[model samples]
Target chain A: MVENRPFLSFLTHLVLIVGVVIVVFPVYLAFVASTHGNGDFLSGLVPLLPGPNLIENYRLMLTEGISTAGAPPLWIMLGNSLVIAIIIAVGKIAISLLSAYAIVFFKFPFRLLAFWIIFITLMLPVEVRIIPTFKVVADLGLLNSYVGLTLPLIASATATFLFRQFFLTIPDELMEAARVDGAGPLKFFRDILLPLSRTNIAALFVILFIYGWVQYLWPLLVTTDSRYYTVVMGIKRLAATADGEPQWHLVMAAVMLAMLPPVLVVIFMQRLFVKGLVETEK
Target chain B: MATINLVDLKKNYGSVPAVKGINLSVKDGELIVLVGPSGCGKSTLLRMVAGLESVTSGRIEIAGRDVVKAEPAERDIAMVFQNYALYPHMTVRQNLEYGLKNRGTPREEIDRRVKEAADILEIGPMLDRKPRQLSGGQRQRVAMGRAIVREPAAFLFDEPLSNLDAKLRVQMRVEIRKLQRRLKTTSLYVTHDQLEAMTLADRLVVMNNGLVEQLGTPTEVYDRPATLFVAGFIGSPPMNLLSLESIAGAPGFEGLNLPDGTDVIGIRPDQLVLDQPTGQNLALAASVELLEPIGGESHLHVRLTGSNQAVILSVPGRPDIAEGAAVTLYARPADLHPFNRESGRRTDTAVANP
Candidate 1:
């Protein structure tokens, strides 16, 4: 009977493969378009295979000395993305781990209530809080600064919640053993609990890095000056049809730059992310 | 080596009391084991002594210093957990050295103690291997190494050998006892296995429902359990306890002044005799129900001819008897214990020779 279900099975695989292609094909197309000049891209000549002008195209994209009004240098924006992604990734993971450890292991009054309140933030969308959050940042003198861009995005509900769940799965007896080994709360956390949570931290690092890297609206609204723009924000500002029709090649180049860090993070830390989810079940 | 004293130690989680107020003391170089069924607070009491659990109202003294308010480190205690809790990322040598390193022990001393512990545990060759790479017994040895390197005031073990296989548990039990004796360190070990308690404890503190039922040498606890719970809880196949209507009535005889209105007769299967002359002792007439031969020993299960309850006699070798045979068995009066059925208390009585 399973063998006879040929059409259904074939259609299922076809639908799945087509869905994957649809999601990934846009990025592939952007890479192809970035390889060519604006005219070739406008003519809908999609490059199926590698072409010969790779160096020339890269030189044209990097031509910042000509005082081109629109395009930011691809490498510079890529570097900026790495900085922001690294800062936010490291900051978010550290804060989330500390917050999660406090909530999970510490003995304090109203801890459960605090955990619930922090968890409730996950239910509210960023759009609803964006206006007030921006006003608060502006009042705090953080606008157009790295602090403004990162502070709003660094302390995440998802990371804390994910890590808290992960911490709970650690056997309490192990913590007790650490305590008996002469480790105080800080020492226990540093020497024992924190080291054991590597897979979770690695997984959360990739997750938070991606979340910060892909952020468009928050960074766009926070940094009014283009000099402080993130890679994602830079991509949007460059791709806009403000002066005339959109510069598709420049936009694709910036978008491609903005997408690089996240792709690399996923590729490098895929095992950690998969391992984290597997351990969370345990 | 140190002495530990627990005075009225109690622990409560919300409304449920996990460990009722308990008092205990350990002399220097003594191995006291807290043993009970699950949820009986044996582990909780042990944790309290280690300062891992907050004392509701008590005074815990380690080597004559009050440690109730002190951190576990301040109390100078080392513990082996049920799961062994060897740092999964660290090798046996690293796991053993971590506590000393954190305490700022000199490198030479740390190395000396780690090597000494590895040699003591016979795990010297496996020192560089991580916990995940080792077997359960190996991890258990590493846990022991960690504790031994501390040379703390008292060593606390919370069901440390429970995770191993039965044969391994028995073997480790002997190793632990030998190690403790050689080191002469005061230790408090907790386990639910009565056999572990009986064999390893210099003195056993048997608890039930958060209360200490009996505390004494293993032989004392076994031969003269102060409470019915202790009598019933220990021993394999447990003690056979039968309810008797009166200590001075038809069930009672010249040899036993089974107190008037007594309700239970506690008899050890080994103490039960198969052959009794017509006028030798209290005859418990019964029909043979089953005979189970477990190697050199034969367990004869018998149902009293006129009674619903059956009695079991564990004897050496097989008896020339088949099932369904009617027989009268007798036991010396000294071999029985009469307990207050209402309170489950073992009532005292002088044994009389028949």
Candidate 2:
């Protein structure tokens, strides 16, 4: 941005354009393929432009779905994905806010030990303990339910640590003043701490929502019923055909549908999300 | 209104004592300023009185009721912190009303008190603004208004004006003094600025190193400092402490009576005059090092001719004196404060407190 020479400016724009094409071209191809008829993809090269059957291809995926792939219609999977994502985001924020509050404010015995236990969980994400987590969910009879879909991934150490670090930067005098104002710990958390953490909650909600949205392995393992199959698992089911080549048009349509919510969420909360991540002056 | 009595109060952080054993009595409607340098435990003492800090061992009585075990809210005292700890998320009106709402005050009463505080502080215009939107002085007013709306038994101010600019600090200092007088509430204020301590305090509790060095009215502490610490800590340019051995041969020491074991003699800067005064006086021959003219008065930094010990003379106006010029400075014997090396307390009287 500082250099304004003609050659440097031209080089800068050239590099940026190339990078944008590298990243966006695949998504562009998915959109292009989603617009085409099923057999048109077998013509060897993906169409560079929109085709004649864009609405028809999307409608078929939404209503009739690919029965050959054994996945449910797109609408039901999207609904399930939305529900799980929303629940995980809300549940993680609530639990993490309280846990971080306790860890930072209270002086109970083994306080650091408790915090470290939560922090150490960062090293062992769902992927590392997928088998045991699935076994526990199965033993609890929570399979094929929304609880099974969201609960294992709900205890987020990263969000808890983030909230804890943010909470620590708040001046202690605010708490002292609140206590002098006759606010108990719970009242202080609700009245003072909660409102102050609004942006952070929004930021973490976007992240945790996307995290829940893209989950594949755990949801795939827990839910045997199609009712509980999230869009992520449904998309994988749609792509891995048992008998022949997968329908590239239907799969790309499902891919575009699955990518919509998170993209919209990021777009809507983008300002607050970035502010919560970088702005620490408050 | 209430009287605060601290009976042998102490606070120990691990093994290090922040506020060692101390006793202080703040009468109803008396504004007692605890003045000391940093790490002197003045703020710790104020916090202890506010019940924000747990008492290591002692009794704190407010209005004749024991409150060492009580919560800060239960103690019925409000504190204005140094940072003006206004709730950032709350509007000024909301910040003023928060305490009353928490205490479940009647809605009309809260409104009435907040309005009164706003009127008094002249912050009515800023009622809807957040702390970040207001200027530093406005925020300070809000901080005071927050305490005033509480209608508490006592107010504790922890260096509330230290965060302001110099001009604003002087303005707020005067305003705080006027406000305290009008409210007539028992208050404990802590600050490291000696000038602020001298100006605002009805009674000054000069402290040093976790202990009260002297406790009296501002003029009383200034005129007769109980210890060398009070002597040095309370003044602007600070009292000059000349070793008795170094000034033994000086002209002024001939008529000065002996106080046995009085090795250090403290003299006020203003007391050292260039012209000889009547009555018994100690004349020290010295050469000027620097002349600092601070508008109405000038501080002449001089070094003793023989021993080369530095002494400051506060003259009334800009004197036509050049640096390195030999001048004989005279100080009356009565103005001298005698202190022993070992005790660090005044040797002129058995009891340092008058």
Report the number of the highest-DockQ candidate. Answer: 2
Candidate 1 per-residue lDDT over residues A1-282, each given as its tens digit: 556687999998999999999998888887777666656655656676545555665665555511244445666656656777789899988888899999999889999998999899888756778999999999999988888888877767888998898789788877877777777889888887777888888887888788777777987788766557667767666666556656666566666666766888899999988987675422
Docking category of candidate 1? medium
Model 1 lDDT tens row, B277-329: 35446777778989999989999998865555877889889888989998777
| DockQ, cand. 2 | 0.72
Q: Which candidate has the top score in lDDT?
A: 2
Q: What's the TM-score of each model vs. the native?
A: 0.91, 0.97
Q: Which pairs, if any, clash in model 1? A: B244-B263, B247-B258
Candidate 1 ranges with C-alpha deviation above 4 Å: A1-24, A41-53, A65-71, A242-244, A279-282, B14-18, B246-252, B259-263, B277-279, B349-354
lDDT of 1 at A197: 86
**What DockQ number belongs to candidate 1?**
0.51
Query: In angstroms, how far off is A209's CA in candidate 1?
Result: 1.6
Candidate 1's clash total is: 2
Candidate 1, residue A33: lDDT: 72
lDDT of 2 by residue, B48-145 (tens): 98888889999999999999989999999999999988999899999999999999999999999999999999999999998999999999999999
Q: How close is each model in CA RMSD to the real structure?
A: 3.3, 1.7
